[model samples]
Target: MSTELTRNFSIIAHIDHGKTTLSDRLLEFTSTISDRQKQDQLLDAMDLEREKGITIKSHPVAMKYKAKDGKTYNLNLLDTPGHVDFSYEVARSLAACEGAILMIDAAQGVEAQTMANLHLALDQNLLIIPVLNKIDLPAADVDKCKQQLEDILAIPAEDAIPASAKNGIGIEDILEAVVARVPAPVENPDKLLRATVFDSIYDAFRGVVSYVRVFSGSIRKGQRIKLFATGKTYEVKECGVFTPKMTKRDELVAGDVGYFIANMKTADEAKIGDTVTDSTHPCPEALPGYKEIQPMVFSGIYPVDSSDYEALKMAMGKLQINDAAFTFSSESSTALGFGFRCGFLGLLHMEIIQERLRREFNMDVISTYPSVIYQVTKTNGEEEIVDNPTMLPEQQVIQEIREPMVRIFIMIPGDYIGDIMALVMEKRGEVTHTETIDDMRIMLTAELPLAEILIDFNDRMKSMTRGYGSMDYEHCGYRPAKMVKMDIMIASEPVEAFSTIVHRDKAEGYGRALAIRLKDVIPQQLFVVAIQACIGGKIIASERISAMRKNVTAKCYGGDISRKRKLLEKQKKGKEKMKAFGKVNIPQDAFIKVLKSGD
Candidate 1:
């Protein structure tokens, strides 16, 4: 085993609790970034994360922090995803770190998600360094937060350094604590070289760049290393350490973290939790890795033009390089023709990826309602997966279907507890446990079917809690819950392209909301639209829009029949492109709107 000389720790915090900001200060302290032009959340370089004010992905950075005792040590830091949807990613990243810096908001103390992460860290047996962040704020109550942390986390409260990461207060103290309390990384050099890949990103020129922490022995460039999970060997072309903005140093040793570039190009081959070992002297056994993440939330995405299908595929492919949770396959429909079926970690993840695809890839897409995958077993004992609600097998063919269940945790003030409980009960959620956080706050744990959360759960939770609640969930298991297939009908006829399987309790609300949203975004055409929600053969509710009763006059204004005829022809061509649903001709924009609203 390696001596504890350099510690590997990750910064785990709730959304917007200054995890990235503190990370930036750490980088500045290490001279990775210029002191004159320091930016907030340097690691959150993605435009979407910045706009959302959340960390959607985990980023790893290496820095050299000099302790107050005059000892220089290497620090490999991982900035983990703060959202509940990316909980699986956080777990994988946690496995790579020996310790974690738990950052708690001073005013908020410990949130539902903070407990969830702390529990995960405990499960992984990682040493934890607790810090109370934003303590300089007027609302900051460092003493109370430290007490709460000590009681809940069972970690020492006296060492809970209070920091205002924004102003750089207590940063040196935080570093000193990390160096003093957090043990260093493993330093077993004589053992077989073993490393755990925690994250990866694709570089167009470099192929798949894998981020790994050497746990056992040494590795150098050009060494043949076998990926234990897949038994594939690759000669390392390059190895180095990383900062938020740069990659420095080479030939990383055990207890140190670094990146390696392989000539291998595929992303799947470099899975997040896969183990890498010396091919010649392979470890007798491979490190235990996680199961392949199956996406529970799915949606259809189509290009505005048929010619852009290839571009859309490439864009999704590029995104999947870093995000292993993103699942996609080319699909076709009679109504929308050819498109892509995208699978996500959850609804939020699905929405973020879709938004990123549109905004970053510059691809206008027509998306379908997000649905969960159901189990289907054929008569001949064939197992099948049904992700698209429209493509589900006939009722008779599906012997049994199940909905995914999630273990949910919520923290809210006492005043709003009634509202939150009522909301949960309405969504078919069952309370499993509850704990009092303080006089007015409680932590509620429940097991909820994932289908119930696909809708406006976040918005509804915030509204019910008066913006004083936080919720996070992890997939528990699939349960045979009371579920139904809700068909989206257009003009009394079920549109196979617009179907979803929702919990019976939520079908009507979602159906009505979908109709309303579609009504708003569908453009006016020569014919009216009939948006109806159906369950099996019964139409629960329906809405109608009258046809385009008025359009530009056919009269030639200034002998520009070319423009007028072109306009009319364009209208006719657009009308012709729509799939006929009785008297309704739904526009592409309506499809996009309905899908976005589903999130």
Candidate 2:
């Protein structure tokens, strides 16, 4: 196919804004999928995605569309995730495309993620075709949404196409606009082979299958290709494009998006964002926007059974094949045994990975509370990056500490502005700006510490706004903060897995609540279990679980009152001895339950 006849574009939108539905309709209109095979969210092939009704991964499909001008165009549609946690996936998809369809809900004019993605697309200088979706809904207000597009995005209401992707309304108009408005790829088949590997998947039979967008030259089967970043070379075993499924081809020319399988044993060998080039003819430098993704939240993942340690490691290795954003290092905990200190972009990302491990790998795992990375400087002028609270140095050696911060954007109803502002202030956030989107809704921008909103913030926001508020954030580097390490101890022994770094002002309250919750979850033992929260050997909060009582005087029913009292006194003496010498056995559920306190 000629480069002029190809269109590479992506559908970017907020969560539940009809991106997948729109893609399905496009596939159907172009005859990419037959009517008999049509289904809701056809691009969401994973069961988890179908069940959750959201796209978790970026899906690329090739379609042949016959435009009104009587020309058949090869259209590549990249479907991206809508959640903020997967914003990185959206960035990767945008980097591979020439244009994007910015889909907005007709009822909900503009959301936080929609604005975030729009800014990113503008930054890339990609042609954006603003689309207003879900017009069939009774609540949808097309005119209001169009005005929002005009006022906020500066895209004219006339230019924004209104359509209902569910019923195939204006599907042909979208196709024509994509062909005429979105530019074609700039072909350079004469240059050296240069392709960008946007994504990859592991196949047991074919090794690692990498998805690439050919920018310059052509690649064929049996040709040797080298990754620019890793400097590893492999012979291309097979090459294909997704006709919604892998369809083998003889060769892929410039301006093509497809997959190629090499004899790569591991997915790490061909990293995402790496450049692919012919071994004999290579480019001068790797592609742009290729950098390592740093994780923002850290947690400990341990197997329910200690024997599954090796299995857990194997499962993580397999999971890492497709998801290279998260990182893990082997860690051992006295209370939790062998585990991994895993890092994630956010809470949802962490949850999705854990759920995938359980559903796909059939591994029962326990994840501790999530925390952000901290930069700690010591009195001796040495610095360290602390991801796990237990790894923090002694308080005497610490000189200064810095915590990660994020610039959060929230869009909500005007009625809830006061409540939202109060909530932000409670989380140690400073309001940077506020603007009125319309008479009923407003947009708020605040700078908040990353640690404050890692958990429960979204839920609280939803509750405070009655589910009308939406938020998005990006890391804005770090700021100096007064922090303290809080530790949980049972029977005088510290539980490393339960340690956390907290702001100095809120440490005492958090510690008190944690101790109380631990008391409720821990069962009574032969010896009293003393749950204590401490900071630098100073006890801030404490709770006690009474020991189980034994009927030592049951045998003598009619005995004198003094005899019964004596027996009780003897039992009390025995209990004191047991409390001093015996160890308190804490159940695994206790550890899991304490982590759910939103610490």
Candidate 3:
């Protein structure tokens, strides 16, 4: 019989490197999901994640594996988020396990993000099992990839497991490596229950569902546990594991990953990195972890149709239930009608959430450009949250206006390095270091302001490099930088909702492009509309829409006064159905044209 030892580990890979598909095969092998029902990527339970082909959050699952030694071991698998925007979730997931199965796409070799993740995993001191995935492809270069992995990550190359996660080859070897190298959890039979809250999501009925890693002791249903950080205690109403699927376990002991329900509702109660302890004898302190995340990108999300304001608010609330990173507050606007201001982890996260809101919730939204939070010191030496572009204080009156900056890493073909460098320069990015990864690929390190890449930066990068360049960035604190105000003018007056803080160097290009784009989208209306870019009180540029002179005509009474009134009634109804921008009402395509032109 195989030994009764257990292993708790997680599979972490860059986006789309077969992590989910491999997890599915493991689930099928253990019969968690039947072959007939196994579509693919079983642990990607979220409909949005599965449909988007990117894991926005990490999910924990449990499975029983039968080894060749004829022994059964419980495997707790955590599938982590792959996007850079979700790296905080990834770190929490890694901390939950004693080992990590790092899957590298054999054909593509190691990527910039793959290296970043590897460094984070090393810092955790988890046993690393390097697996070369997608070996079934003809272009797979196992030997070369092995050499690079060893050279780059300083790990053993010969030990790298080559397997097709799609076809289940070498999966047994992967399990064997885990059982051999990964240490089993140390059980504390006498100690009170303690678990780490790796991540949490909100459920309508359950409040917050905390996914925890049981560290030292056993926990049972109906037991009272205290969340150390928040000093909140609640009775466990439910407990279960991802047997590839969620399987209810009456009691989960040390060395297992599971979900528990604490009627201690509210998403803020069970914060990630907090510890779970017995309520009767609480732990002295919470677990040591990274500091709480601070939002670096700010944007305004407005409802396109004012009539759907209530629906948009409800939809945003529902979306935030699962996405704790989203910080929002409702505000009213004459221009936007009504909407909420949103803070995001970064630009990508902002875009992803916006797209999700539109596609899944069917809510049409107008998003302002992503701007970084400005550190404004008042005359009394106090601080405030200033996100609006027009709200900036005068340079002389300001004590200091600090901007957030980050360390950016990019991997691109050598031939496209110059073009990428030029783009970065235009964004006020400064190169810190450059290294050659291979004859074809080069790695660039730069310190860039977060606001620089908030707009069509991603699209522009892809277009310039022909999709051969990719980048990842982490906030590196703040710096003193030149700042300019971007004003969105409606008619001839500046709209407070449209102002943003941008680096002085980039203001002209971005402002001009936006003005041009708005000109096309703002539509011809009953009155003329003008789009202007301003720095402080001065308008730098403007784009105007000619006045619409003939959209309506008056009708006289046709013998009967009521008959003429009926004709006017029809015209009023038609005008009422059109979209209103400022004082002008426009047709449907007007708004659509601005979005499509992307000027």
Candidate 4:
């Protein structure tokens, strides 16, 4: 197809805003899938995504649509993840498109994430088409949501399309709007070949399959290509486009979206956001807006069976091919054995990776509590990054410590404003501004520590507002804070995996709560198990699990009382000896349960 006949676009929305459902409708309207093969959330592809009703990865598909204007156009659709954790993925997807379809829930109206993504689309200078989905529901207020788009985003109500993606209502109108409004890609087939790699996956039979958007020229089968970022060249074994599935093609031309298979062994060589250009006639400059993704949360992942360490590493290698945002390195703990300290975009990203390792690889793994990275400076004028609390330097040598901060945006009903303010204040947040979106709703902005809200802040906000509140946040550099390292010790030995960085004001309370909770979960051993929380050398909280008692006197009920007393003393002495020499065997589940307590 020629460049003028092609339109590249992406569908973006907040979580549960019907982005996938709308994409499914478009596929059906274009007759891309047979009626027998049609299913709800057809673009999701993964079992976890289907069950969770969320898109974990960005997907691209090409369709041929016959518009009402008697023209057949090639439409390329990119479905992006809606969660805040995957914002980086969304940004990369937008960079590959010339337009975006901004979807909003008709009943929910504009949300925190909606505004965040809208700003990203605007920054990219992409033509945005505002859409209100799920209009068939009786509760859906199309008029009110249209007003929201105007007041919050400055989008005209008439320009917004209201449709029921679930029932295929107004699907034709949306497709027609794409043809009439969205502009076509600029043709440059005569220039040097330059394609942008937006996504990729590993194939056991074919090696790495990279999804690309051709900008300046063409890529044919058997041609040599070089990656602009890595400066590595590879022979293109096969080239094709996604017909919702891989279909081999002779060549992929300019303004086309497709995949190319090269005999590349690993994902690091063909990194996302890299430029692919012809080896013989290379492009002098790479594309702009390429930035490395930084992880916001860090945790330790250990295999339940120590022998599975190698298998775990191999599994991670495969998973990383699809997810470039995740990072890990070798780390060891005396309590947990060999493991990897992994970094993630956010809490949801951390959970999804853990779940995939267990379900897809069939490996049982233990994950420690998530933490934010901190900057620590030494007395000798040296600075280091500390993701794990056990890696923190000694208190005497530390000159200063800084923790990450975020600018948080929240939207909730006016009735619950007081409760939300109280919750944010408790987390050491300061309110910066407030504005009324409508008579019944308001938006609140605050500056909060990243550590305080990385775990349970979203759950708490929903609970306080009766499931009517939504929130989104972005990293806002770092600031100095009064922090301390708190450690948990079992049987007088510190467990490095359980150590964490906490604020000094709440250290005592958090320590007491954690100690009490660990005592209940850890099984009672032959010897009494003492769980203590300490800072530096001072024990702030302690709890004890009494040893299991064996009825030593049951067999001598008819014996003399002195004889029974003698047996009791011997038992007491034996227990004391066990307590002094025996080591406690902590179970795997106990560690998981203890770490999940604070959330």
Top-TM-score candidate index: 2
lDDT per residue as tens, model 1, 1-599: 23455878888888768888898888887887777767776787688888888888788887777787777777778888888888887888788888899999998888878888889888889988888999888998888888887777777888678788888898888778778877776555467888888888878888888888888877788889999767899998888887764464556677877888878677668777888899998887777787678788888888878799999988888788779889888899766779998888877787788788898889888787777777766566777777877766666556667778888889899888778888888878888898888776898899887877887887899988878899988888777755667887775556666677876777788788878876777676566567889887777767786677547654556876688878778777666565353355566656656665654
lDDT of 2 by residue, 1-599 (tens): 99999999999999999999999999988899888998888999878899988898899999999888889999998999999999888888888899999999998889999999998888888999989998999999999998899899898888899899988898889889999999999976467888999988777687778899998888899999999878989999999899899999999888899999988877569698999999988887777855578899999999989999999998888777778787888999888899999999999889889999999889998988899999999999998999989889998999999999999999999999999999999999999999999988999999999999998889999999999999999989999999999999899988887789999899999999988988898888887788999999999999999889899989877957999899999999999998889887778878877775554
Selected candidate, larger lDDT, 2 vs 3: 2
RMSD to true structure for each model, in Å: 6.2, 1.6, 6.1, 2.0
Candidate 2: minimum summed lDDT over ten consecutive residues — where?
590-599
User: After best superposition, candidate 1 residue 334: deviation in angstroms?
Assistant: 1.5
lDDT of candidate 4 over 1-599, digit per residue (tens):
77888999999999999999999999999998889878898888878899998999999999999988788999999999999899988998999889999999998889999999998898889999988999999889999998888899999999999899999988998888887788898855468898999989888888889999999889999999999888989899999888788888999998889999989878678698999999989988887745798999999999989999999998888888889898888999887899999999999999999999998899899888788999999899999999999889998899999999999999999999999999999999998999999887899999999999988899999999998899999999999999889999899988887899999889889889988988889888877888999989999999999989998989896957998899989999999999889888788788778766653
Q: Return the TM-score for each candidate structure.
A: 0.87, 0.97, 0.87, 0.96
| Model 4 C-alpha RMSD to native | 2.0
Higher-scoring candidate on lDDT, 1 or 3: 1
* Candidate 4: segments with Cα more than 4 A from true spot: 188-190, 549-577, 596-599
Of candidates 4 and 1, the better by TM-score: 4
Assess candidate 4 and give its lDDT: 0.90
Which whole-number lDDT from 0 to 100 does residue 548 have in model 3? 61
Residue 536 in model 1: lDDT:
72
